[model samples]
Target: MATFTPTKPRTIGHVDHGKTTLTAATTKVLAAEGNAKAIAFDEIDKAPEEKERGITISRSHVELPIVSGSGLYALQGTNEELGEKAILKLMDADPVRQLYRPFVMPIEDIFYIQGRGTVATGHVEQGTIKVGEEVEILGLTQGEPLKTTVTGVEMFKKLVDRGEAGCKVGLLLPGLKHGDVQRGMVIAKHGTLKTYKKFEAQIVYVLSKFYLRTADITEKVQLPDDVKMVMPGDNVTATFELTLPYPLDHGQIFSLREGDRTVAAGVVSKVLS
Candidate 1:
């Protein structure tokens, strides 16, 4: 079978923002074209509260066809009634993209165990990790990636020889210190990941205070559209500079957050070299 790249989409906004309606429309259109995955389009609003209130009270998943890609794409219709923090939890729990690489784990924290040397903790983003496997740490500093080896793996205080993506665990690395690597860094199969400081993305409309931001400055920049300020609903393609280098891949879904609210969400389209 020919391979197809998958793009997962989510409808985001405040309560009663029509997230379900948009998702249903996409599902209906896909079903008309003989796509079986979209047949259960109405299931998204299956919650009793949604039917009674005519609002989306829970999340839904469907495989809808993308008019441009001509392929079925996984779409998530999020619960419109969720608060900012709850919404973030939903996003992280059911993240749009799935890991398919050899091994990809974004570092969340790093520390030195009493005797275990340098320990980095994070959930495996993709692929499988095994003890004694050599890996590379990306986005720590510019230039080439920092090379290291996995000396130990522990999940919930239990020793494990292997771990797959999404499994939360701490990995032990020798000859490294907590100061050497920190959060926002990525651990992946050697030579398989790239880091970036700038990228281009397709931002979907939602509750946002600022879409364009300046590096290390509180002043916000004018969007390419030149709008005085972006509001709760608007679509714009804008280039953004990451606060720190990241290994975010193209077609991956992410969100712009502040405090507890996610101001906006988007898909990484082009990696700006």
Candidate 2:
């Protein structure tokens, strides 16, 4: 039972300076050394088929992996293309915070690759993981554990065989359809997390300032459920229910938004299962 604290290594170089070649070569060297199981990550590049046919990414970053204990740094390989940031949209927050204690990754979005399968992108809230290990999707199914293995991990366009607590990562789950998962789910080791539909919380009502009259609703459109009528107040205890089951713990703070606007902020007071 090995724990992987993966790292993302992006090659900083210019166009045609052999970044892909450098990535691919790293995979080969690691495979030869039996250090890690190397995986060459390739993103599609478009050139007129009459010209280069299938030229991989030339300027952007891509992830290539070598799965094992510490995972391999062997991505510098093969033909592939990806965004300059590589895997998912990179959001660099908490730059000064090195806090890695828990092992919960809440799904922000999921993307599908033509050949690789479903990729769930999120920031590591706590803990670490490596490819080839099994993880459970908390709060997605009722009692039935949504278990899947990590086929791949990537960050900032570099193949990361494992991941740490604070990195923005893309977890690759092969054979999963995009619809099988959604935003706001948590990924964790099996049996390590819990999901709930109803909870008690203390919420600061913000939308109260815009107390819409009954005429507003009848005359126009409906607001988001979270934007219910409320009076401005210090803090109020509220019962919260998610349309879908979601992993939540006591003391968790969350934003309640109506469409795109924040209506309220909540802190978990008690988790009702």
Candidate 3:
């Protein structure tokens, strides 16, 4: 069977530059060449306002398959204004260092099978894990992290011997009950994860009023004194304090939301406490 690696082709350009149209055209061309399946133009720009204004108002993603060796890859495609040389430069840039980091999976849900024990389902954020290896469950409980053994790994219902970064898999953890684990908890390679209630982060495009939300709670937080006047598109370093500790690590990215809308994004720069 032939395997395909998913690649994201970024469409970045000024307004009304036909970024969406170009993407739709490229999809059709790739389909004609048997490189990808054709996606309908309407599907690419389906928002009502987008149809009325004939421009995309929100960021969107389209998966394009590239026939390459097994691994994740990124492809940059921009309008003429950005130029092909810019894309070439990006392709030659160094790969992100976080891709090589340790295993970390924030538990999204938990299930208890009658005979197999507890199953924790989540997407692996980074690193690799295999059956029979030990993992630490962090966050849900305070103080020390909980250790558990991975009895099995299953992806899309098919039993796999191991799981790695980018894979959404279920880990069969024995000796754990449903109540013992929750959505906000995190699982990582033993001794590699830490829980923190305070941390310094570099945030971008944050609104004046927003809440720091995690899996279990959403708490209002203030921007540091230096960045209180930050505006959209500005990058600022700020310290954030959460009501509860979470399994956070350096370079881990998070979102700041006001109610249901995400107004900003941030990356953990340092753990303060």
Quantify all predictions' global Cα lDDT against the true fold.
Answer: 0.63, 0.60, 0.68
lDDT of 1 by residue, 72-175 (tens): 22334333233222332332444444556679887877888776688888878779888899999877465677788998887656677777665677898887
TM-scores, all models, native as reference: 0.56, 0.55, 0.60
lDDT (Cα, tens digit) per residue for candidate 3, span 1-273? 222233454545579665665566555545555777766656877789988987788763322333222111112333522433332343344333234678888888899999878999987878888889999887746667778899988875667777777667889999886688888688989988778788888998765342322274444455776554877788888877776678766787788766667778888899888
By the lDDT metric, which is better: model 1 or model 3?
Answer: 3
Give the lDDT of residue 183 in candidate 3.
83
RMSD of each: 13.7, 13.3, 10.3
Error of 1 at 35 (Å): 34
- For model 2, how does the per-residue alpha-carbon lDDT over 1-273 read when each residue is reduced to its tens digit? 233343354544555545455455455555666754545534323455513644444343433342221112224322223322232112232244334555668787889999878899987877877889888876555556578999988876667667776677899988777677767567887788776767777777744211110001111122346756666565667665555556677888766546657676767788875
Displacement of residue 131 (Cα, Å) in model 1 is 0.9
How much is 55 displaced in model 3, in angstroms?
Answer: 33
Q: Backbone clashes in each candidate structure, one number apiece?
A: 1, 19, 0
Model 1 lDDT at residue 256? 65
The TM-score of predicted model 3 comes to 0.60
Worst 10 residues of 2 by lDDT: 211-220
> Worst 10-residue stretch by lDDT in candidate 1?
212-221
